[model samples]
Target: MSATDPPPKRRASIGARRNPASQAAILAAARAVLAEQGYSGFSIDAVSRRAGAGKPTIYRWWKSRAELLIEVYAAEKGALRAATTGNLAEDLTAYTAALWDFWRDTPSGRTFRALVAEAQHDETALEALRGKFLPERLQDVRALFGAAVARGEIAAAEVEMRLALYVGFNWYYVLTDRLVDGRAAIPAAMRLVAASLRD
Candidate 1:
């Protein structure tokens, strides 16, 4: 190849440079597919067709459907906050109720459920759940608990145990299709936690 000759054709890098518009299109397409087709119908193939992008393009950016789903959930869920009210029990109850409402009323619920199921079989998904998603969620819980501690409602030593209990309680309700019942149950559960902390 001579310098005078046309420079060697450069191959476009795969996902090396993410175009913001293209990425948004893919995420929007993913959300549409999840909402319309449900998790069972969700796939890179489906998203590719919907986004007018190729499988390689989607795969280039999101290695697995689970990774794509995580992005979709994060985009859709946005920031979650509960009422502070300077009361631990009220804060917990409000937070749980808000979480239940989000899960039951939006596409996020199904997307999350699918992600959880995928993690059971996919190491990538499992790592994302543990390393990324759960920590973000726990941060919110910690903030709420930290507020409670500041109010002198609970000792600092109890936050970790309460955090675990709070997460497990929410997971059990969501997984069991008990979000409806969870509304009434949330206040009672919050009161129990508050009582236990006070003891």
Candidate 2:
């Protein structure tokens, strides 16, 4: 191919290059790589190779493996919409259990563990993890709690504290304690959040 030549054909994956669907294709590929390879083994070359994308494409979108993996986290975790209902306890339990199920049943959870460990050294991943991804997830849960408040099911003061309290307390379990054997844990915490909505 010469400078005048056109770009290669686009991949149908989550983060391909040149096409609008490329981003999605690449992220899917990245998740696969992260799952198979773990933190130290994940790489742009691997993801692009698997994604059928160019190295430049990965670099263009993500600054590092952590960034790419985190995006997968954001998307799968519903960065925009966490859950469907606003029943407070029902929504919280649903989303939380969904999250636990995601980690326990899929390779994504392993990648998440790696990402968490890697975040300690990489300030960029840490910032992305804390600022954007975490906030967005919390916001979704908060909205649910807010709904409960509107319904007089819970107090407004306890809304923001829901996800943190749950995630913070359960972090060790999901990260190291093992939430499931080969299936979902049902995440006992999700129930507590709902039950705690009252006196």
Candidate 3:
């Protein structure tokens, strides 16, 4: 309580000690487990041991494995990142590049694929994927498409269709034989998406 006492560290949540180092360690450990085991197989016990924290400490912070996975996802998934440069092509390129880069990195890439497969059977997981992971990326793309529509470079009517097409085409390559290695498909994806949105 003395003035000489060092000011407290920045607090993130409403009621928790805010030590950046601890949080980073926990998150890093969680990511390693998520990447290695996927969300379904991951557990707080393993995460605690890996994080060098106690079970109570982990439980004190995260209510459930789902909550842990949620944080793991937000921190790991770069696909949710977006750009708004006022140029549609640049915007899409930036978004897709970030996405491909994230996917190419083994940490998030393997986990994301597992998440997709998990979503196929789990309703709650599917909801989280759509509401939390999928829409964030889609929103940015929609905004870029809307900008192009405003500029008269593309029709507003085809925005949703184009986004869906882009996703479908890109995912097609990832799912089939891992052949979409950005060799001839990345720019082609950009081109196909751009053309699909054209007036």
lDDT (0 to 1) per candidate: 0.77, 0.68, 0.67
lDDT of 3 at 26: 74
Candidate 1 clash pair list = none
Model 3 lowest lDDT segment of ten: 7-16
The regions of model 3 sitting more than 4 angstroms off are 1-25, 35-41, 52-67, 77-94, 177-183, 196-199
TM-score of each: 0.83, 0.73, 0.67
lDDT per residue for candidate 2 within 1-199, as digits (tens), equals 2357665465544453346677767787777777777667888887886666877777777776667777777676663356647566567666766667776666666577766776799898898777766776567667777777887776778766765676775577667746665224444656676665444
Report how far residue 183 has shifted in candidate 1, in Å.
2.3
- The best-first sequence of candidates by lDDT reads 1, 2, 3
lDDT of 1 by residue, 6-75 (tens): 5322234446577676788789888888888888888898777667677787788887777788888877
lDDT of 3: 0.67
In model 3, the Cα lDDT at residue 32 comes to 80
Expressed as tens digits, the lDDT of each residue in 36-134 for candidate 3 is 776566888777767666666666676556556766766666436676666666677777776666665656565666666677888866777776667
- Native-structure RMSD, model 2: 6.1
- Top model number, lDDT: 1
For candidate 1, what is the TM-score?
Answer: 0.83
Task: Tell me the lDDT of candidate 2.
Answer: 0.68
Better of 1 and 2 by TM-score: 1
